[model samples]
Target: MADNQFSLLSKRRFAPFFATQALGAFNDNVFRNALVILIAFGVAGLSSQQINTWSNVAAGLFILPFFLFSANAGQWAEKFEKSRSIRYIKLLEIAIMCAAAIGFYFKSLPVLVGVLFLMGTQSALFGPIKYSILPQQLKPEELVGGNGLVSGGTFLMILLGTLLGGALMAHPGLGTTWVSVAVLVIAVSGYLASRHIPLAPASNPDLKLNWNPFTETVRILGFLRGNRAVLNSVLGVSWFWFFGSMFLAQLPNYTREYLGGGAQVAPLVLALFSIGIGLGSMLCEKLSGRRVEIGLVPLGAIGLTVFGLDLYFARPEAATVTGLTAMEFLRAPGSLRIVADLLLIGLFGGFYIVPLLSLIQTRAPRDRLSRIIAANNILNAVFMVTAAVLALVLFAAGLTIPQVLLVTAILNALVATYIFSLVPEFLMRFISWLLVSALYRIRVQGTDRVPDEGPAVVVCNHVSYMDALIVMGCVKRPVRFVMYHRIFKIPVMSWIFRTARCIPIAPAKEDPELMERAFAEIEAALANGELIGLFPEGALTRDGEIAAFRSGIERIIAARPVPVVPMALRGMWESMWSRRGSGVGRMRLPRRFRARVELVADEPMSPSEVTAATLEARVRGLRGDAA
Candidate 1:
């Protein structure tokens, strides 16, 4: 499963997973898009008060389940077979589709609103299980590629769903009936596809449950509290949803006012944005070579800023009277730049988000990963709600749609600053990046041999924590670093680790529970199509030579079917903090301005025959003449 990239692409194991994901994405958007159409167009045919009230109800119903049922769903994800769980959920969609038909037939606002809530309930349930299952089905190196595909597939489905929704909603006779029928077909197809999915055993068996959202929310936070990286990654992801939700929600006004188009233009803008994200996501898998490379964070951050700012500047003075075709949109005033900005923004967004997601899955403790996801879901909900409120305030303040977007872009910079400043690992990578650029030049061989995206377990000799940071700096994707829990607690430094979503581990003797959590996190990361970086030696080299490799990494690889991409730190160990005695445990020490480093990749090794011992041996072989 590891390096059999073609095999993975060909097999039932992955195919079913892909179908299931695509179907889910398609269905959610189908229902959501229909509802949006109803509100935007169909509502005008009714009383304004009725429209406002129904819209309010619909919004509340849709969002309430995340607050109410997400905790329980997350619990279920951790306690049962993931595939079995997904199958049952797919069946639930059929019933929801039936409800959608009822709503559309009667055009009953209350019934439709109720179904939207029910749909949200379905979504809430699927959220945890969906993410928690990825690490179980794919290989480590495939996590990024898998995630890239998933993200790419999801947005594509989003586009498809919207397109279908528009087409169906347009024809009075076929609109509602066909939507229900189409939903029914998709849901049934998904269920059938899911039946073929391989079973994924739960990571935690003797786990306790708290169905209560309040108590469960507390518990979920407690799980995140133990690991700063998990907490920050959760924050980073929440922010994406927060900021992204705001951006997507305002498209109607943006298209109408800023771009000088009408309702038709709104979907086009969304299409462009979504397609951009899809394209960017695919590029991550191609760029990163299958390992979770943290460098993508900085890269993503840069793209987000560049495109967001450019989009603001790309705005035209007045709206266009005619609805332009996609190509015509390019010919409109500032339109080409706007489209480019949006697409590039989405492209970088994929790079930014997929790694952190993979990091979360790879680094969270397995036993509590569901709870962690639940916590993440809750946080995401909170941030998204805040985004709505913030948008309302901005709009109410008389800000134009584009102006609001500009403000959002400016806010993103501040948010990123806070997160990165909070977690120095991201900053540390930047520092490492600078050192490599200024002092030592890097020449990578066999870089093409690395999988561009997916969950990957990267094995390299441990010289310093800087080893992970250095690797993160060179690689093109975001990586979830598996590091000692103590190192994760270092002040300021811990923030970087947390923000970068490093998985914290405790040695078995000190805290076996934590060891379990680390494994769970790794599983979750892989499940989310992310990369997990591990130092097989487990600790920094004491005598400037690689230590005996541990079997923990092998266990992770065996659990997740991702590739084991080995790398060599040819020059880092000799430069900055390779101190014989005092350097390993020393804190707050600085090696300011006198360091040189180079990280070189070797070929990826499949987990099929590459046991921990074998992988360790390969890493040792690569360390030749380095120390």
Candidate 2:
């Protein structure tokens, strides 16, 4: 396996798939852009209003197939080997591009538009396979990076294709010929790339194919809703598409009417946005420490709204100067700010989306992930259509483009708030992620020793109040920590702890009933195949030394025999939250900010071989002299 996301690009498993998808995205945009340009410029005897109507019709026709065929596409993805399906889909693209070439040669608008609908059907079929294949090919630790690369690459190719197509069509006499040749070559290249993709076996080999789109759409949606977190993540992804489509749909006009810029300026703004998305997508692996880290989702949401609203304020009025060229527009007053706003919006949009896609892949059932993704595609198409309709309605009511953007930004905040409210986990993780990342630079090791699934108890040393947060941030799986009741009740942190479902425990001497209840909960959680985290030392260390392991671990294990994983948190004793500065009873600010900390895990021990003393010794060895 590759150590980093970019390194995966050099490997066989990922590179071929990436190339195939990137080529497909490029070809789709190439065809679409060429068709639009041909309609707007090449075709004669058409008024501007008619061109506008045709453009709108083009968009609608392309989106229609997703609504009609996504359910069946999902079924096909689940029922057949993915690589084979991809090859067939690529072949279908070849046939479509052939039709496109014929349409281009004859300069037939209806034939070109029909080819666009077929292209959409091809994309709709590819959508489910595109995402669902990732989890099969990559490890959990690689999902974030993998998703980041895919999202970034997709957008980058779209930009390149748009530029190429538009440039080709701008040629006076040979424009159609150039476009037809380009589409054919790109489609053939995509098919060739698809041939290199390694075999990815079908997830549900025996899944009965559902031929009816209407009935299967409902069934797939039910599959999506089976897991609340996965469903919301899908909703979050669809909302991102909605938000993005509206912004993209308005950009040309926004550039023309508001910035008083020529056609060149629109693409410039688009290039900046596209590059920002790529940069932000590449940054997700580092920011998340290469985990799914949906904590970044809320942070992303905040950025999207802030920059979105700022864009409106940055340019509320139309420019007095008309028809400024791209370079001249960039030189105008407040232009850089507007550019910055769009760039940051794209950057945050990348942050907001990558994790949601990763979450859906990780959380959705293996057999039905493609179906859930299909449902997501359906909703995305619906939301995109809704965005277009809403824009028309707002324009009819006489709102300027800037004002409409302002409305979209406000609605984004409201929608994000609603989604986060339903799943407080996103917000909770964000808070912990923010605090821990601010206070410490965490280095996690041997997390792969923790079981990816099934029940286990993880025992670590008690070092500081931030131990759970540090461990939570480092470990890939969610840990239900058993904490001292007092520590669990600490103001703002309490809400996070409660929301994370941390087990609040009291010492037997102080509250026997609470201790017993905590024990019962641990047992139940173990039976339900959830990981339980425990500080076997039972309290924060009075000194920066390993305390003797308490017998409570033994009691818990005796009730439910499960594997015990030993973990250690090091370099935390000197932190602000620890007892080092003041005394065992209080904490003070650290001498150094952003202290370096480490969480190390040893291999799991069977119940028969585990003992409190042995576990403590193992953790102490893992911690070593770090404290």
Candidate 3:
């Protein structure tokens, strides 16, 4: 069961949701695939160019609904029971499918495209409800795994759906009658799947629902701003859509003209692309060990960069390959490289997006989660629209399809660099990443064994700047470390540590002015009920021995009186940073990973129970074998 993907499919709570989602994704592609093929191949004897124009138009219509309707859809998700909403949305899909059947029967492009817009509208309504319901039904540990399944399943369905739709449309027997039959079957199956979903009650039962888009957009942003992590996750989600939309909207053209396979080959390339994303998503749970690891963010960015670059180089030079079916293309050596390159693009996409969504789910406040999702949908729509426009402009500028792909890949690298540069925690995680790799790798236990939603004054032995970074690495909640004023001034690290808002402390004897300011800042931060972290040992151990904890820790705890979590800096004593003979030495800078290190948080102590001796002894005991 653990090894099998279908094991998740068999569970009732998951299966029906999976089926409903799959059906939705399938219907979306079926219509889209049919439309694009109709254009690309001259279905119904229409001119190929006319079909292509209409196909792009159909794409625009589907995405247009998100701009006009996402706000209302988000409200609906929050204002009503999600299961019931799913039922109604499913029924709506059935209606749209009937409309599609009508258009298919008549071979009317206008009616078919209208149905595409209707289908998009239906999906827009489902978007907010779809994500908002998941956190409610899933356990915390299961959230990452659940989201992985959802993303993997959704992308896989897209590939399957694309294949199904193309197959149906291309069939010699797929006249109006056959098309109508397929539509009805898909609709009914989707409705039946929706029927089996377990009821998920509305999260914000008492919330006042707003209907106006302008006011509601403002409301949603305001709601989103309430959680910093959620806000960043939304931006990350929007960026991904911007990134992916650029590639996906271009592939069909690239497949036909650049790969020289022409229209029939478009869906094949897309399926390869979607499958890569599904594979990457499916691997996430195992990679994360079932935790929502933000560290994967950089990994995804790196993968996106490397694979996207290779994909550019993988495109065959324009002459040798004229046209071929999927099999012939696969057998061709160059095509296989292109295929592998594309699969990895999608794989990286999976790595890029899944955790971001999971982050939003886990970090967003419960009450406003739906609204934030709605905002995310709107931004996704915006980015996608921008991508479409950019593709049109770039293609119109007389660049070939392959050139457009190369340009986007380059832009992706530049964009990733900017984001990581802006938020160095992404890079800071890189340092912590290397440390974890080289070390025996201690597991963080009972970290929720700390506090979920309150101020904590954490006391520990100071070892190095890496000490603060390591602790920040292990803890989920952001901590404000009281770093030594001079260490905080280290060039590259200075910016990152300061941005993390680490309080810079100076020893009184060396700099009384800076020391006083540091105390004032510490009090100010603690007075606001923020977590204030500082090491009492004052400096790294000179000979792998704990220094006497300073009195500043005692003063801070006495003044703030928050729960003080005694922490230990184990084996970091032997890390390259701590091995310096002098109290401060140039010998140990943060290496890829130091020889070995661990930051362990012991049980919390009330202010009354905390004393210098008690804190030292507790840190010593927790350090255990390292001590």
Per-candidate TM-scores read 0.74, 0.96, 0.83
Model 3 residue 450 lDDT score: 59
Residue-by-residue lDDT tens digits, candidate 2, 226-257: 67888899899999999999999899889998
Error of 1 at 144 (Å): 1.5
Expressed as tens digits, the lDDT of each residue in 159-182 for candidate 3 is: 887777777777775644655677
Q: What is the lDDT of candidate 1?
A: 0.77
Which candidate has the top score in lDDT? Answer: 2
lDDT of 1 by residue, 79-160 (tens): 8888899999999988898888898887777788888998899889988877777878876667777777788789889889
List the global CA lDDT of all models. Answer: 0.77, 0.91, 0.76
Candidate 1: stretches off by over 4 Å? 1-7, 43-45, 320-322, 325-327, 430-627
Q: Against the true structure, candidate 2 has what lDDT?
A: 0.91
Error of 2 at 358 (Å): 1.1
Judge candidate 1 at residue 318 and give its lDDT: 54
lDDT ranking, best first: 2, 1, 3
